[model samples]
Target: MYCAELGISYEIVPTKFDEVKKRPFTDINPNGRCPGAIIQYIIEQYDTEKTLTYNTLQERHHLKQWLQFQMSG
Candidate 1:
């Protein structure tokens, strides 16, 4: 959803349940997850050149806060 809004192309890679089981700590999270891990994965996958743009630092901060709110809720 966010990628579409931001005009970025993204693909959702599926993680196998059996593969996830090999890592014990993967399930010990809120909803069994962490935003940073997902964010890092996206960054690594799509932003390999680190070329994504933010018109301003404020926009970045605002997006971060908004993501935090969504995660918290």
Candidate 2:
């Protein structure tokens, strides 16, 4: 959703979303980062203009903390 809102071009590869339990993707992404981490990474890499975030250094850290909280849950 943030990717779309930020105008980042992407495609839906249905095969990638296949049953993970049946066909684990650990072979592809060994680390297997959580959803929040992935989202935060995308925002950091693509939200260069900080449209979805803020320019303040403190705000960025706060965002990361929140992302971690989501991961913990």
Best by lDDT: 2
lDDT to native, each model: 0.57, 0.73
**Best of the candidates, TM-score:** 2
Q: Give the TM-score of candidate 1.
A: 0.42
- In candidate 2, what residue range of length 10 has the lowest lDDT sum? 15-24
RMSD of 2: 3.3
- TM for every model, in the order presented, reads 0.42, 0.62
Which whole-number lDDT from 0 to 100 does residue 35 have in model 2?
56
TM-score of 2: 0.62
**lDDT by residue (tens digit), candidate 2, 1-73:** 8889889888865754344323366555554433576687888799888798998899988988887887665
